[model samples]
Target: MSKLDIKQLTKQIIDGVGGEENIVSAAHCSTRLRIVLKDDSLIETDIVAEIDGVKGSFNNGGQFQIILGTGLVNQVYQEFLVQTDLSEVGKEELKEIASSKLNIAQRILKALADVFVPILPALVASGLLMGLNNLLTAEGLFVSGETVIGAYPQFADLAEMINIFANTAFVFLPILIGFYAAKIFGGTPVLGAVIGAIMIHPDLLNGYSYGQAVLDNTVPVWNVFGFEIAKVGYQGTVLPVIGAAFVLAKTEKVLRKFIPMMLDNIITPLLAVLFTASFTFIAIGPVMRVVGDWMTNGVMWLFFELGPIGGAIYGVVYPLLVITGMHHSLVTSEMQILANIETLGGSPTFAVVAASNVAQGAAALAVFYLFKKDVKMKAIASAAGISALLGITEPAVFGVNLKLKYPFVAALIGSAAGAAYATWREVLSVSQGPAGLPGVIVIRPQSMVQYMVALGIAFVVTFVVTILFAKMSQGKSKLN
Candidate 1:
């Protein structure tokens, strides 16, 4: 068999899928090409799946997806953008760049975006309701004696449920991430989730003390093979579990291949579980917890040194982080900040970040209005924009902003402006929450008002800019 050049194979795969002409818009989930087609009738699903580098093809939830393994999916998507004429109007000059000084940073930012996309909606809805709960509770609406309308009574229980669901994701998110990591590593998700569950177990939590001394003047008290171990918590974490699961999966695979067939099924699983669990508890978790703590300390250093400016910078950078999936790296830091501060009361940049999402959504809406003739693009734009307004930016950013050239620029502009205002005002949040407009209410009410004003200005700026740019660049070429 001839060895296939992956680059050439990827190009061929895209060409086979209606040659970009049949593609309406293209985005990605974790491991699949979530493509919208100009005409589904033109797609030859079987033939596409048969292509050299293609994994599989399927249609679900009104999306025609082509599955490709992790790293290759984005490469294939880029190939489509470069080889085809799907470039949005006015942004043709920015297409097909092979290298740049900021390439590393850009890649990192894109990773952050991807990691947060799947969890955005749930985070937003919960954060929004959480903020509302605070507002209603403070205003004597929920527990007040004087009330003509029973809106408070009807919503109180529902609000509590939403709050629990939203916070639960952050509290136990490691388990969910571990499941996905396991799948990525070709291991059983259940096994990985069990590892995460162990890390967060009550016994483990009760055993670790934050300020306990592990060493006295360089002489270690706690030691594993003469190495001092740092005591730390692993709840709501990411890297440690993922790294451990990968090792476990590889070990499982190796054991299955080498062990005698008679003992493989029972003995392999038992060994895999025992070894992996022991390694995690005795080694990986402690090491990773130290690393996570160091990272939190670094972020805190910046926060204290730069104050609101640091937050504004974080806000401006966060969306790009979301794009690349590196945002997972920040989760430990954010959670630590919450644990330390107990409230977002000292920093206002959270509100700015939330506002930027609204701006991105507004930009999408602008694209929809400007591209009236392209009904499919219009619908996608509308859906994405509306979703963003409601605090879900995955559909807007991945489905629309990045695809439509002007929208991303609009979002950037809005984010920068909003961040600047947030920094200037010194607005502070009362709690940590999702990145969206409704989540802005987590800030002190007075600060939230200022944040809302900043967001309003950002929305207008982004909307106007996107509309003007879209109209100015109209008729250059359609997305299809």
Candidate 2:
């Protein structure tokens, strides 16, 4: 929209949402303008729906949201802020306001999302490279039942290098986590990296090999002034680094407050890192490690042990979690699953996610056909469908499915059926990636075909069911 048009729309939005007074805070994510309101009852959602540029709107997890779709939400959000005199509200302050209403669980999840979102590109790139490396190293797929490297001896060095490059992210995951987690928890990013490095330093016994070392009766420990503390490195752990960073950030902030300005510069950082490191190595790291292990084991048991039933249940609830915005929190769990890939066999959670994503996309695609005459809706559904198929589903869910109601239910049924098949066949991923068609790049070579079939089931089931539901809604009357 033009400058004047945006300004006009912004004014209309301000008026529609009970003016600036009703809004506690406002922010925007990929495609939605999210606002926390003092009174939800005062929200003029009908008026919001009538506003130009608003594709849809809803209230979820204390945030009243208006779906503006991609490429435009930011524009509207910026203008909304100017009109509401909230131009000075920065990201951190806005987050503080937005998080005030969230429960403990929600806040924790949101923190994970904040830390992981910035580093997602790194994870995605590494996952894709890992998948390529897997195909190159795996046997019985291409070239006379031997691995690609075996068939072509000339490429052996190249294959090894690819493997190294692919595994780098997972091996040094704590460092990345520490840096981002520190940023999230309000600590120095570089200091976080130093602490992260300390956890995986060569002087320490590798955490990955600690289990084996225990079996061999060779677990190493440091005599810390009479205390026997394990000198174990947290190679691929998530929670330990996160906890350590939180402590580091809080400790550094406290030191900065009490220390004199002259000596504070040198002493504060040094003491903060030293104290945080000592405490982490002594307590936080080990304790959090056990907690992390339990959480991983529980999820592993559900997907790998309970089989199809577990997968079906998770599939049904995945969309609900998305609605509540808690699904973003799963990034950390996905990391843990990938870290233990050798023991867990592979990552089934990713495969199930792929099924759920495909079903949502397929359902939205059906809506595009169902509302062919409504140009605005058709556009939203078309774009949302494609985006969901590419592993982003918020637009599809909020803009297309929930608006009509039946499409959401269709997606759930389809997702459940597809996820069951994935679990039954034990489909697995070699690395983490997108949750739809692109995710196939990361699936284990042996499970690739089966993974595709699972998504196909989701697409077909959701598409067919959405159509049937729309048609059955009324004999002579049209669906809203």
Candidate 3:
């Protein structure tokens, strides 16, 4: 869209939202302009939808979002700020406003999002490194049932080095989770890290070998007041550290309130560490560990036991989860899966995500051609389609597919089929990355070909279904 067009559309949107006075705060993601309105009833949804550049609009998390697609959103948002004379206070304030409107459950999920969002970079890089190492060491690259390490013995040390680099994140995952969770729960970040370190102390037996230790009858324990507490390291566990962080943060806060300022710094840290560690090792750690195991077993049942049927169900509901913003919780689940990548074989969830994402992209691509006569829609669909293929789907979803009912349904069908096939084939990613075609880099060496084939099936299915649906709806005219 042109500069003039953006400015004009911004004006119309402002008027539709009952002007600058009604808008409390504003933020923009890749595809939509998110605005917090002081008076919810003041905004005119029909008027906003009528605007030329708007692909779609909705109310989510107490924010009114107007979809304008990739590059165009930033332009319109800038123009919006200019027209309204609104300060660039940004997303933080919007988050606060949104939080106040959320229920207890939503707030809890938001906390999880906050704690995990910053950790993605480290995890993503590690995953990619691991993927590369897997490729380097995998068998059958040149000959059937022959290993790469055998072919190139000189690179073995380098591959082993890469493996160590990749394992660092998962090995010390609790420290990362604790520090962030502490920050989120309003505690000392360092204290959280300290508690995390305590959980994985060298003297303690590793959690990964807990089963083996039990089988061998070598599980170590500390007897305290007639109670036996196991000393198992939570190396790759998530929930235990999070619970420990919360306890640590709360303990520090309470201690500070009661203890005098003169002795506060020294006594507070001392008591906080000792108490948090004792409680964590004794109560919180064991309890959360059991809960975490339940979660692990649940996911294993869905993604492994049910296999293709599970994949289909997940694919079908994935889009719905995205719409509700509940998908953020899945990051924690993926972490658990990826943490035990050695044991789990592969991440079926990532494969399902890729299928779902690419299916949406394909649906958008079909729309781009279908609406070629309309310049604004064609631009929106084309940009959204490409963006979705790159692993970001909000643009394609809200901007094109979701707005057009048929394409969304088509994408769902494609996603289900692809996920089922991929799961059945046992396709899995080595790392967390984009779900688009470009995401192939993260696929494990053995599954790269299978992943590509699955995604190709998804693309074809979505495109064909969209075209057929659109043609069927041509006379009925209920697309939007």
Candidate 4:
């Protein structure tokens, strides 16, 4: 309701948090000022929360978060930066600092997230279009055509064009992975792109359908430096490409050290690409792929052996994993399912993920309704709930449910129940997309209704349970 001095507000927040000495790192996302504190006990929570323009404050995921609205948060964060020496602290650095506090497993999971998260937008967009194409060309939707004209008598060209859009991302997925992975590893992105291009060159056999060639004993192999190398392209691969990128980055760094400044442009990139590509194909690609398959099968074995109970546990753990930034590690499993539906069956992981996502939104919605008197919190909850339903749960998880504590537990219970029901029904998703309400777009057509039922279960159960929790807590459990 009132404009206040940002400098004053920044000073208050820093001083309240025991000054810059107490803060390990600081970063901001959309609607919160996220800070990692060296000592939580030293934080003057009440003082910081009482600051004007501050909406709410809480700690989760190893970060002390202040819920300032988007525009205000950025401004305060900038002023806070100016007042302190944390100006150079970027999001990645802060993430690393936060992740350092986690155990080895969590650190590995976070590393997995770091690799996959940046690439998710490409995956989501392409997956959505592909799903729509499948739906449009389904048996009852479009008649099968024997010839080009017969296939699309009216919209043949349009259909062909749309198919290209749907297929491009997946077709060039390795290139995308290379570009992003190289950037993440601090290498020249163009070198990674070149390496990716080499992997999928026209001379190479298609990796996706190479099994038939293997069965027929016709798969191509190349003799290089007395080593036999597979000539299969990496189309939908995950680990091999990422591993290759890391290798390329390290190799380039080593090259940079010895190569003179003037000769760098020609020698550095050439040597880097040449060595890295050879090393990747000769060793890294084959080895990481086997490791990736092992990880995928391990997860699938647990899912099938445990059946519905496994799905329930997966659903419960996923949201908590999200808070710790570990759930994205499961992408390797989902990628396997997406690429090998015939062998692996469709993805049960999606059914559980959808359940978890909807439950998060439901929990946030309940908090919104229960905290009707706390206008700022109610506003935050409403925004977060909407975000979660759209398949982005960070706002809902960090800004609302986890902040409130009890609601997060209630959501976990609801998620487990809903996931068990979905697993029993054998609901499956064919591709990646936003989970929760939007998940219906990517689920198998035959199982779409069942998936919807699972979502409804998650939402209703979480909402009801959270309401009860809020009522019992009597407003005392809220974060200020």
Q: After superposition, how far is residue 76 of candidate 1 from its true place, in Å?
A: 20
Please write out the lDDT profile of model 4 over residues 279-380, one tens digit for every residue.
888899889878877877776765777888988989988987776566767876677556565355467898898899889999999999988798877887
TM-score ranking from best candidate downward: 3, 2, 4, 1
Question: Mind sharing the TM-score for model 4?
Answer: 0.82
TM-score of 1: 0.56
Off by over 4 Å in 2: 1-8, 24-31, 34-36, 59-63, 69-82, 88-97, 342-345, 372-375, 475-480
How far in Å is the alpha carbon of 387 misplaced in model 4?
Answer: 3.2
Write one digit per residue (lDDT tens) for candidate 1, span 121-222.
554454555555556545444446533124447766766776575466656656765665665566777777777676666645322244343332332234
Q: What is the lDDT of residue 95 in candidate 3?
A: 80
In the range 248-271, model 2's lDDT, one tens digit per residue, is: 999989999999999987998899
True-structure lDDT of candidate 1: 0.62
Better of 2 and 4 by TM-score: 2
The alpha-carbon lDDT assigned to residue 391 of candidate 1 equals 73
Taking the tens digit of each residue's C-alpha lDDT, what string does model 3 give over 79-128?
A: 88888887775676788887777778878778887888888889888889
Off by over 4 Å in 1: 1-180, 201-208, 212-233, 298-304, 319-353, 364-384, 391-407, 420-451, 464-480
The whole-model lDDT of each prediction reads 0.62, 0.85, 0.86, 0.79
